[model samples]
Target: MFSTYLFFFLSTVALISAVMVLLSKKPIHGVLYLTLTFFTLAGHYILLNAQFLAVVHIIVYAGAIMVLFLFTVMLLNLNIEGEFQKSTLMKFVAAIAGGMLFLVLIGTLKSFDVATVGNPELTQIGLVKNLGKTLYSEYLMPFELSSILFLSAMVGAVMLGKTTKK
Candidate 1:
């Protein structure tokens, strides 16, 4: 009962914040809404009994990614007034496309037979260790490569901001 109530509350907050993220004119406000969305999603992960995933979700999305977005917004000093789009046609088209997407997703899910859930055998090991083993063994190379890519992007952003005129 408590979990159900918490899930409903968190989900509503997450959805509202996500919508606000798209609607907020200030880039910083949008980034903050995005961080709220991430934190709520991490709460949902905890409700699902995936504590390790909850921590990682918070660390990755809220702590790292949203902070990066906030930094970029501040670095550019993005103004709400300068970023307004005056295209009603584009807005209408986006609304239609989003509605179609939601309909298609609901239809697809209603037609599917969900897989049966089974009890997981943890083998008496901590979840963090298990997750780390899986990540490092099965997905190490791609993970490291992505980290390098992010590092390169950081360097590029810094260089572009600094190296302008001769």
Candidate 2:
């Protein structure tokens, strides 16, 4: 019961922050709101017993990605004077489209079956130990291949980044 309430609390905060990310006038405020949304998502992952995922979510999204976003926003020097103003007709159309999307989402949620998604008892699949074991034992070949692929991609990126003499 308590977990359910906590889940709802985190979900509500996430939704609000996500909306704020879209509604915020300043780019920096939107980035901050996006970070808050990511934190709430990490909270939800923790509530779901996916601690590893939660930590990664915070590290990758709230930490690295948010920093990159903030730097970009700062460097861009966004201001309202250069902002493109939306026409009244465009705003009305956007509102109607948003309303329709919201109705579709509500209908989808109403039709979702809770019983089909029940959590299994004593599940530890999301834990780092189990994940490492599975990755190293069962999916070792694909994992190693992906690592090599990523390494090659990094090398290619470095080569491209190097300036060639004219």
TM-score of 1: 0.80
Would you list the C-alpha lDDT of every candidate in the order shown?
0.82, 0.84
Query: Candidate 2: worst 10 consecutive residues by lDDT?
Result: 113-122
- Positional deviation of residue 145's Cα in model 1 after best superposition, in angstroms: 4.2
- Candidate 2 residue lDDT tens string, 92-146: 8998999999999999999986575658325688789987899899999999899
Please list the residue runs of candidate 1 whose C-alpha ends up more than 4 Å from where it truly belongs after superposition. 119-126, 143-151, 154-159
| Clashing residue pairs in candidate 1 (N, C-alpha, C atoms within 3 angstroms) | none
Please write out the lDDT profile of model 1 over residues 47-113, one tens digit for every residue. Answer: 7667788888888888888887887777887755536685989988998999999999999998898
What value does the lDDT take at residue 154 in candidate 1?
Answer: 92
Error of 2 at 120 (Å): 6.2
